[model samples]
Target: MSLPPRAHQLHVLACHACGMVLEDALDSTGHGRCPRCTAVLHRRRPNSIARAWALLIAGLLFYIPANVLPVMFTSRLGSGSDNTILQGVIEFWHGGSYGVALVIFIASVVVPCSKFVILGLLLITVQRRSAWARRERARLYRLVELVGYWSMLDVLVVAIVAALVKFQSLSDIEPRSGILFFGMVVILTMLSAMQFDPRLIWDSEDT
Candidate 1:
């Protein structure tokens, strides 16, 4: 008897949670619910394209305020000032903590914006059913997903800085509206990436 092909090429849906094959389940429910894990199974995620587009657009919109607004408020000896993400990075860079500044700039600004552009390109190419570099497109999806969570590094940095300064006698730090906006952007992008079905890249044979 011939063994089945690799698991991913099965052309069958499975329980995303419990690893249960769901091809048979489709005959029963329009969207089958896994008996083992209760996850809703689909040959393809329902409205995957639409949902990802919506989330991506929202993330893009939020990206504006995330950068423009101040992310932190700092007061030392009764003199206080607000710092946006770029401002903080510039200050850090000038203050000789270039490494931390670079990390913050990349994680906070570059990563988020690039994720938007990358997701946008993926969605468009998938919609057009463009067969260009199908394998590489799948790889791109993986790369974006891997880096998505790292954008939270900026938030972590802010929180740490705030905590450290909270107890200082003449200096204190508090997060600003921009940080909240940036967090929303990160979350929306993550959801967008999750909503995209990488399998779509492999659905068609490469030209």
Candidate 2:
């Protein structure tokens, strides 16, 4: 089957932000701005693949420390305890807070690992220019972006809990290094997703 012609083939560009179609002639300086929303337009994001890969790798490195080290330090009655991400989840589960445990497990462990795997898969497939599963790959990229937003839930939870525990006379909760690492993973993955251009999935087909 023949593919449809792209907008650039007709000397037009679509605004990524507002979806406005502008004539190629308007792009005098290599960069173009949409008249409606004035958002800058690019044929494709510059260095999208390379930037995404770099961020993904950095996030992966941080993921190790994020899970291994202590995320929260709790002190009560002259005794202190440190809890890693998994340890905290286990404690919540054993303490009968199943809902909270499930949320944290999904947000902290499952989400980050899934993002890494999916992003890595998309990156590899796109770089190889594989025409296989083009539609499904496109959907996977969108799904990555959607779930990236919730990846920071665990960090927020730690912060809120620490703040609430600050007022207790005999107990205190403070964030540890692991939470910082986890936060970096979340930010890096989110930026990696943003850097990716989903349009690339169809480039080979269009060619």
Which candidate's lDDT is highest?
2
Clashes of 2: 0
- Candidate 1, residues 84-188, lDDT tens digits: the string is 999988998999999998888889888888899889999999998888998788888999998889999888888998888874658899999999999999999
Report the Cα lDDT for residue 91, model 1. Answer: 95
Q: lDDT tens string, model 2, 1-207?
A: 976788777888788898888787655776667789988888888899999999999999999999999999998976889999999899999999999999889988888999999999999999999899989999988888888879788889889989889746588999999999999999999999999988888878755
User: Can you give the TM-score per candidate against the true fold?
Assistant: 0.89, 0.92
Please report, in order, the local distance difference test score of every candidate based on alpha carbons.
0.86, 0.89
Error of 2 at 10 (Å): 3.0
Q: Highest TM-score: which candidate?
A: 2
